[model samples]
Target: MSNQKDHHYIPQFLLRQWTGEDGRLVRFYKPHATKLMAEWVYPSQVGFEKHLYSTRNPSRRGRNWLENDFLQRVDSMAARSHAKMVQSPVVGLSDAEMSAWSIFVRTLFHRSPSGFKSTQFHSIRIWEETVREIGPRYAQMKGPDDPETIDEYIREGINGAAYDQVLEHFPDTMMSSRVGQFLNNLHHAYLR
Candidate 1:
């Protein structure tokens, strides 16, 4: 017997996309809901936390971890993001919010126990090196800590790091995982 309440965060359609190569849902799925899940997911209709597994499941410990470290960070970033947007025409949220949310989601995906960790940031490091080889002093300038610098570069058409160039020069660093493919595809999507 399974419970639907554990997985109320992720939309069913989005959840369906995470199926394994064996054509079955990954083992991470569950149905537990957090009280604040609605507050976190609010105004958007459904209360969902896409990358989180189950807040109530003891095996996952999602509620404890999120309430402790993850959501705290997102909330802090959201405040800063909201502050920056007050002056910009970027609408909804300025890049601060967008970047913060992106990082939070990406981090959650990285921390996820069963599925989202399938393709992590470390798994795509080769692509960054390959990108450096193609050109763009930004990679060297930003150094090791700031990965979002690449996103900043893409968002800025002023630099030589254009979308077409990234696609054309993307490396073939396949390590027997679709993670390689996802990184390449992510570049394409990230640019847009």
Candidate 2:
């Protein structure tokens, strides 16, 4: 139900750093098979896809929950960290700032179209393997209304619904957990 439609995988604050005096950055892309195109466009105009992070499920909190709730917070924190790093790359960041920047970098990767595709491919592969391995064990626990066999359960009940759930939520979960691990294991030292 959220009003936001455009979601930027690359944060505007980061892109703004490269903007020209006219407040637009030069964007280049292939417009067609025979043409390459370039234009001066606002950062907001180039980096977003409409409803890229939107969820279709009515039971969820909001359609734009990922964009409005999670990404905005990450971008806000990273904006501060980015400013500090811009001012002084080596010495400006505190431990918290470093952590924020790390999270932002990792998030930027996972949120981009290419990264999302890659993650989706891997996640689906993993999920399919997991379901194949565990689906039979859980078949005995099925209620009267459920599919009679594990194979039937997988095909008739689990495939579409579970795949959608995994596709919708797994990237966020993976990003969060990986960021936590990255922060926990990170060590900083100055070498002369």
Candidate 3:
């Protein structure tokens, strides 16, 4: 999956930026702090889903009309991306896997205008960590020679009872609220 070469809403270079030197996904990618995203991060190249839900700098008043108009279209693509946020775009754990994780979880991490309980937030945080970190950690356990071990570990993390137990800690309200319902619907359509 890592080598599939698919389109990305959040650029892989950017995502790799967030990875810790030890290969964990830290909150920020600190290694290349001075890199400028000007030529690299282009909103026009992103898909509608990413444009709508994941775009970070939507209203910067671009240098030209075309850029500005494109940004507006990106904003109007809100049917997919509605969290008009700048600065920190994606944060923490997410329902999404691989490339989709950061985009899907941005709203949960911020954007809702209301906050979540520490327990609920922790459940969310831990769940994503469990899904993401399990494979690499598993390699450390079983030795790094088995690439299949990563897949097995990920499957275990997803289908395992331990994963289910962590989810059980997530607030029911977090799953039942309006925002939760919206996420559920979105999941059924795109993720499930």
Candidate 4:
């Protein structure tokens, strides 16, 4: 999937979502220290969904603005608007998810030796120790002569479970409000 250039949205959206807060997304790729670096650690060429979502119709009925050629131009404009409006945008993670996602993103950015927890939860350690514990496993799993790639190596040892488990330790109310809004949006968008 990674090599297939056509499947752009999944990675692009995930990467973008990592950075954007609420309605705003980033236009330029900045370093990790910037809070605008939210969901993604890398700069990505904007994908078609972002392009489609930003397009508008010419007021002629029955025309699919989503499929229009002019959309690309609009996409650039939207990207710029997104960048300008969201300069230093902050997407606060729930306290539960906060530490976990921070470490997850940091591990991705640093490319430090670490693996995701798959079987059962491990003790939460300071970032440095966490990397140390994970270093050996990462070394074992990472094959000789394998090229280092964040997407390939860090993909495992991580799943919804890792996020969910850490998140479970947090009081439900901490995220219930956000989850409720997400569910409501999902319902309206898909089930309506």
- What lDDT does the true structure give each of the candidates? 0.39, 0.73, 0.36, 0.35
Ranked by lDDT, top first: 2, 1, 3, 4
Model 2 misplaced regions, further than 4 Å? 88-91, 134-139, 144-160, 167-192
Which candidate number has the best lDDT? Answer: 2
CA lDDT of 9 in candidate 4?
25
Candidate 2 local Cα displacement, residue 12, angstroms: 0.6
Off by over 4 Å in 4: 1-68, 89-192
lDDT of 2: 0.73
Measured against the true structure, the TM-scores of the candidates, in listed sequence, are 0.25, 0.76, 0.21, 0.18
Best model number under TM-score:
2
- Give each model's clash number: 8, 0, 3, 4
Which stretch of 10 consecutive residues in model 3 shows the poorest summed lDDT? 48-57
lDDT of 1 by residue, 1-192 (tens): 123222232333333334556444534323565322212222222434443432333324333344334444554674465454444454454334565545544444434434332432333344455655646666667756545565554344223223223222212221213553343334311211
Model 4 lDDT tens row, 68-94: 322223334334433433445533334
Ranking by TM-score: 2, 1, 3, 4
Can you tell me which runs of candidate 3 are displaced by over 4 Å? 1-31, 40-107, 110-121, 124-159, 165-172, 177-192
Q: Compared with the true structure, what per-residue lDDT tens digits does model 3 show for residues 1-192?
A: 211222233433334434555544523223577953432323323321311222122223322222123223332343223222222544223343211333235323422213323433465456656557765566567755543576665455444433344334333332335654465455332221
* Tens digit of per-residue lDDT, candidate 2, span 1-192: 379898898899989989999999999999798999999999889888887766555336577777887788888988997776666334667767776777777787688877766776677677667767876577678788877777776675344555456546844663586666677467755433
Cα-based RMSD of the predictions, in order?
A: 18.9, 3.9, 18.0, 18.0
Residue 153 lDDT in candidate 1: 45
Which should have the higher TM-score, number 3 or number 4? Answer: 3
Write out the backbone clash pairs for model 1.
5-31, 5-32, 6-31, 6-32, 7-31, 7-32, 9-48, 9-49
